[model samples]
Target: MKAFITLVFITVTLATYAQTKYSNEFMNIGVDAAALGMSNAVTASTKDVNAGYWNPAGLVNLEDRQLALMHSSYFANIANYDYAAFAMPLDDRSAFGISLIRFAVDDILDTTQLIDDQGNVNYDRISLFSTADYGLTFSYARKLPVQGLNYGVNAKVIRRIIGDFANSWGFGFDAAIQFKTDNNWEFGVMARDITTTFNSWSYDEEAFERVQNAVEGQNQELPETTEITIPKLQLGVAKTYTFHYDYTLRAELDLNMRFAQNNDIISTSFASINPALGFEFGYIDMIYLRGGVGNFQNELQIDNSESLSFQPSFGLGFKYNGIHVDYAFTDIGDQSVALYSNVFSLKLDFSIFR
Candidate 1:
């Protein structure tokens, strides 16, 4: 087991090295923080739950105070993540909200190299590496009763810190429009990551030294360095019909698209049409079941003629009072079980101000 873990560490290091810093590291994190993450979309217009994270326009329809917390993570050794939020309405025309999210990879053994004057490699401190992502957000939504539509905007300032190496500060804003049909068919459009980003490499000695060197062979580097922006656009539609008094079947479809600055990276710009179907039969909304599959865009054959493909994912959750817990599983086969990874998260939410 120890050897397997060590091998995984090496593989992850090299895999991350081949790509850019922070590549895909934060991609799968913070998903379980929202029940919507479990079903791609949960009863969207219900008070201002974490559902807002998936569709900002949903905030416009909230009626009262709502708070939520979600935790989930994966990998063989386990990576931890956290997400939380609160939202409410004012004057029957506007709403406000705030949120927090985190990503942490713990117990990572730091490699060390010691040298005796000759600058030889020597193992040193047994440390770990970690990173966290958090954002303070404010949002407002106005209802146009004449058209039965809602238009909203959200502003968030984000901070990303990675160990002692890199830190970044940026601002983002999202615009969303939502409206429902006469038959209660809801539709929403949202665009995310529309702000500029700058990563503070100076926060770390090692990363800064590398930047300085790159500038040596060229013109003076800019005072503040920045990375490319990754933007995501999504269109969502959902409809629900009562199966019983308090029981209902909710089906949602989201056409999600994320594009990177580099066009040659064809995979980054591709879109995923995620269809999630869920059934909620709770008497007082105390429990839920959610299952969905995504990331199955392509098929590939392994090196030796064996074929490998992206696997489907499923999750389950239960809620009581104001707290919730969830778990997700991905099956990639027995040999690939170690890489399949299981994600588990806990959510905490409650109403405080009526």
Candidate 2:
């Protein structure tokens, strides 16, 4: 009962700050500094363990095994997001990976509007709770008999909890396919939440009921609702160029199209579509510089003018002796000045180190 009440507080706190495009919005934030640095435009160019969350087919690039961990400071230190992934090559033709991510806010103080019989504010009744979102995914990829063709699928489980007020469980599926050519051109197609992910929420009304009589002026009731996250199709293409100086340059583009309206975020009258572009420059495979732009939206108008929304990102990376560290700066938009997010990630390739 205590846990449930705490969760209720968490739920209310989360509802006050939710700014999402769909259900399970945390999953859409993207994982790993390396990818975010490029505005997550590497769907076709992605390789290694992080592919567990991107294009699983990219796991084929792992010779043996790889592990990656990432952390992000989101939205002016209001929340923290973290991810970890591991990929292992099962054989020459198959690979598998697992990934986990968590997003949460802590130290929220909960208060009541009810006043005691003596008309004194209840100072001893303050409660603290946290709201968090979690995702776990299992993925597998296989190379087809046809050269340069590969396919992958992911099974995901999701859970969201609010201090004790509400909790939810959800399931979803994702699939991806990729084709590459000897000339360094790659193409990718991905279907996210192909099964139309649904979240079932259950709320505890005990706390609200306890204060109902005292706070009758403000009518409030715990709500029980189910939310569905619509599916989206993403198409991507990338090209790699190799230089005589042992350097490489790559460019990538991606388009995301929503098939259904997300009542949770955008109005049904508006369309949800966006394009992203990214570039990366690498020196002897040891150092890299990346930059990109994403979240282009022009559907709604604010102040009688076409509302503009876009996020710009950039990053740096270092790799040597089987270890890599990466950092990224992503602008989340104006929050006073321009709010920039900082992300850092580390990766270890056991194939080379062990």
Candidate 3:
């Protein structure tokens, strides 16, 4: 079994050189600290609101109504990402949830080449604008007729805006299945953007043309209306062990692949495959520690050297009286600490108090 797992990891790591490009890449950026700390390998794990985004089927594992909110500074503090979710069990066999994700960059300087009567340059007239992306998700999950199996789906609405000059609207759906065994093993499969999410873009032609003309040999303009997203599949497996019924440990692995056409220099759709590994230690169900590694890929170094990817993450969590707080830190490549990101999340369980 260990050999098989090792082989799979090696295969995924080798394929990491290829990266997928899709609309709303921010959607793939993890929102929950616990999940992010674990390198986003939570498809088969449960008991948290993050499941609404990772694998809806895991919602069935939630034991109480929950409200969760998270925030993170991304990419050298140039942007901010925020997420909020609410989940409640509809009955003994079903659950319902909703979540919102937003990524935004503020105070961007929108500059245009300016010429006075004498063709002089003016740098003081630069205007500021912002770009934002949003996703709203509605989810439902239920226990299947067969024991230990669950299924769920997420319906999503997406929006993107660039300083009032361009904007887009999109819609997509995601589905997942999870199964658990009596021996503390769990498996999950999630099909993200199952129907090929689409985004219709509208741009101010006049403004767009001005920007296009300013750049030399720039002819690739966004379409006025079209689909912008592609489908992806993620599979996960996990196992849990208990020590004297007080201390518990869980290990998980996940594989993610995109099935859409990639037109980049590396045209193989298989190049987008990625693998992740994670571990969690829990104490009395009140405190937790997590570590993970993922986002493996290839990039060009400052000297045009081949550089491999390395992303490590760790997190700490505490729960008290129905409230949970989590903190996580993740390194962004080989850059200094300034390139790293911090994630913080808070969760409240109403049922826990009841």
Candidate 4:
């Protein structure tokens, strides 16, 4: 019972904090090992099914039906993240895509009933529950008459659940544009939650009564039930080069911008910007190696001194007969603050059937 009360307090505190900053953060964790390997720097050069989550405008480049799946674990496997997406060209210059993402922590012990009404400790009274977040995105992209420009939009629905105790639903929209230059340079812009996302929460009062009674004057009232996610933007540029006839190299840089100042490398009262860089090397378009560095932040050390930290990721990919298998070693934060996780993803190009 004590543990359960503590958990409730922590959950409520985190929930309140999230309402003002980093709301719906799971959606930003990203999908596809190929992008994660590049520390999420593929905004300008993403041209596959995974583009639905990165920069949907790139989907217009698809020539055939594509399906992608990815799975990754975080926090020492305490949490699991999964993604699936499908995309197909609608015509010579248009495309459509759909994608789903889920992040969850399952089988958490419910200690609220550790003790019976008679004050008797009963081991069998414990139960389990899960907390999860889900996002569904519908995307559309079309090539514009202006030379190499393409534009896309996404309608997203979000669901959040906390073991039947609480739940919330949200909706948002995103817009993006991708342009390719005659000189092989690509530029992309993604505006996430452009109109702002809103989540309305509902809690079961009966289910929360236990938490209310667990402490005096603590959690006595339900938490605020509304959360707002502000708009964010990403700008990217990429270029690819081919040498030795069969060797190809691609490099991309992205600037992720947030409306409010934070820990990003470039911080201001109006906006904060974080830069990411990624590189991919391909041999005969079959075997590939990738690397990236991003998520730069200033950390306060034990002695109150500030130090710069960043995350580095590496990945490998293989392609054969329209099948692509990729693996990535990524760290959400500096090695000292977080552990590296292994991610695997698969992509299938249906054109192989033809």
The CA-based lDDT of model 2 is what?
0.79
Using all chains and alpha carbons, the TM-scores for the candidates as numbered come to 0.72, 0.88, 0.84, 0.96
> Which model is ahead, 1 or 3, in terms of TM-score?
3
Which regions in candidate 1 have their CA more than 4 angstroms from the true location?
A: 1-39, 42-47, 116-129, 195-200, 206-224, 260-284, 302-311, 317-354
Model 3, range 75-152, lDDT digits (tens) per residue?
778889989999988898999999999999887665544533466768675567777899999999999999899999
Clashing pairs in 1: 69-347, 71-345, 113-122, 114-121, 114-122
List the candidate 2 regions with Cα displacement exceeding 4 Å: 1-21, 113-118, 208-216, 261-271, 299-302, 332-338
**Sort by lDDT, best first: what order?**
4, 2, 3, 1
Candidate 4 lDDT (Cα, whole model)?
A: 0.90
lDDT of 4 at 102: 96
Ranking by TM-score: 4, 2, 3, 1
What is every candidate's alpha-carbon RMSD to the true fold? 6.1, 4.4, 9.5, 1.7
Q: Quick one: best lDDT, which candidate?
A: 4
Q: For each candidate, what is the lDDT? A: 0.53, 0.79, 0.79, 0.90
Deviation of model 1 at 133, angstroms: 3.4
Q: Which lDDT tens digits does candidate 2 get at residues 91-161? A: 99999999999999987665543246677767576677677899999999999998999999999999998
